[model samples]
Target: MNSYFVTATGTDIGKTFCTAGLLRANPTLSAIKPLLSGYEEEQAESSDSGQLLAAMGREATGANISAITPWRYKAPLSPDMAAAREGQSIDYAALLGFCRAELAKGPTLIEGAGGAAVPLTPTKLTVDWIADLGLPVLLVTGSYLGGISHCITTAEFLLRRHISIHAVLLNESPQAPVPEAQTQATLERYLPCRIFPVRRDAGAEDFRTLAL
Candidate 1:
């Protein structure tokens, strides 16, 4: 089955937004955000899990979000810290097991909690978990100030670890410091991977080639 772990250079860099676009582009693939921090029950319809469910042609209801995401923390912090604030801790093994089970079922898009290096457990980095999963990555970055450096640095780190990068998606950010074309060109020069820009309202056809 074709699967990928979607991550980003940092928080609010449009990982969910990009993932939703990819889902809209490819409806057959199932999407899940197994671990989520800063989640409030009242905002279920606007949360990352909710957005993912929407992209999959499902309604963004409490049950739907919870079904896809088992671990939800209220604190808007890293998973480890967020879980701690509520007197809870993430079972890294269980989390891995859940993802493995999902992958075994079929093609799945597993979205990470934060940036590539964010700590899921106090001892495990997000990238480390990605490596453990052994799936290619769909990295989402933005065209904002310092974005060029952030994207290149992230790609370099992943490559050094021998992680296969399916693609680098350059999503537009508000008040971008540099044009999207320049950033994409610069990244293409340094990384041996496919680079594409995604619009805020991108359709399935827009991501048709990369969804494969």
Candidate 2:
């Protein structure tokens, strides 16, 4: 099965939006959130992943939400810190099992929580987990000011690690300070990945226009 890991420069950069966009053309594709943090009991009732599933016109029942996301922290903090406060840790092998199970379902899109380098456990970073999954990644970067450095560093790290970066989505969030083209041009020179421009406040139809 063809699969791709969806990571971002930072949290709420539209990883779920871009992933759901892909599903518009390829309905067979399924999404997985391997280690979702900041999911309170109240938030889980209307989670980001659940919203993505809904936009894709899918019910939230089938996707790997619980098994993959073993640690759903109530506090809106980094995964590692949240798990530490709860006196628990993310089990890498169990997370891998969940990923493999999702891939077996069909073409899978695994969305990383926070950023690529987010810490899952005390020792394991999210990028290390993405490497373990062994799928090509599509990075989602918002077209906001100061995003150039974050996006380039992320892509460079992935390249240095020998991970295949399928594409980059430059998400333009609502009322965000826009980035200049020269900054994007700089990133093009340093990073080896395709960059896509996404407009702000895009609906499902607008998101579907994204080619990757």
Candidate 3:
């Protein structure tokens, strides 16, 4: 059962891109993002759920998206706030149950929302869910300025909680201040795990190494 919880230094840092690449590079693998924010059901094909579905060679249907992401919100905010907009909240127990059921299917990558510390609920956090699941984290980060700080900070936070990190991926942003290789080199000194570089125009072949 090769499973990993795909998390990132922060939101829009390419967690979906990296995760989708891995899934595409490895057809046998499966992925699920149980909680979603800023979701527009009508435009499912361009959404994160759609991308992941496409990567897995599946249809981006409403039922398909609903199967992977039971909780979807329209507001582009943290789960706590997004759900609040709908007069609802995260049911941690149900979320845990959904993850557990999905993980049981094997070779799954659970992608978390926002950052590792994003609040899922008032008392429950994204990291708390990762810790509870006891899965190795595949951290995704960007190569922009201050990326090193963001990556290291998140890694340390995971380390402090004794959460094992499978690998750190540096997603190269367009016109990044620093080269992604340099960021990977810098992160190697701090993160006690392998670091993979994701180019801006990289395809599935570029991620084959990490796919297996």
Candidate 4:
């Protein structure tokens, strides 16, 4: 089973949009937001995984959503801290098992919350989990203001850690100061990896542009 994990430099980047793009490209694919903290009932209206399911035309059924994601936290913070606040703890093995199960189903897209090095457990880093899952990664970086440096630094860190990045998605958030096309050009000029800029309103066809 082919799998890709989408991670970014920070929160509020277009990781969800990029994930939706991938799902749109391959409707049969399954996705995982294994640990979704910061989940509020009101915010479910704008939740990442929810939007991804919608983009893929899948109903948020119990079986489908549960099969893809096993953990859901309501605190708007990193998993470790959020779990602490809620008197809960994250199980790494359980998360790995869910990811393995989803990958077994078909080509799966695993979306990482926050950035690469955010804490999953007190001692374990998110990138360590990414290493454990051992899937090729796709980075979704915001391409405005301070994007170029962030993308390059992230790419360098991934390289240093020996993670295989399939490509980089230069996402233009709705309120980005600069136009996406221009940022795309600038990113292409500096970054060595393949960069694809996704629009704020991108759908399936836009996602299909990535060869996975």
| Best model per lDDT | 3
Q: TM-score: which candidate is best? A: 3
lDDT of 4: 0.81
**RMSD in angstroms between candidate 1 and the native structure over all alpha carbons:** 1.2
lDDT of 4 by residue, 34-146 (tens): 87888764555467767777766876665656555677788889989888898999998988887888788888889998988889897888898888988888998986788
User: lDDT of model 1 at residue 210?
Assistant: 76
- Tens-digit lDDT track for model 1 on 1-212? 48999999999999898888878877778989999999989889899999999889898887888778999999999999999999998999999999999988888999999899999887898898999999999999998989989999998888888899999999988888777888899889988999988866677778876746
Ranking by lDDT: 3, 1, 4, 2
Q: Please write out the lDDT profile of model 2 over residues 1-212, one tens digit for every residue.
A: 47899999889888877776776656767776766777765455367666556655766553334643445776677887877778887777888887888788778888888898988777788788888889898899876767888898898888888889987877775555645355556667877777766665555576555554
Could you give the C-alpha RMSD of every candidate to the true structure, in order shown?
1.2, 2.7, 0.9, 2.0
Off by over 4 Å in 3: none
Which parts of model 1 have CA positions greater than 4 angstroms off? none
Q: Report how far off residue 103 is in candidate 3 (Å).
A: 0.8
Whichever of 2 and 4 has more TM-score, that candidate is 4
Tens digits of per-residue lDDT for model 3, 60-107: 999999999999999999999999999999999999999999988888
- Comparing 1 and 2 on lDDT, the stronger one: 1
TM-score of each: 0.96, 0.86, 0.98, 0.91
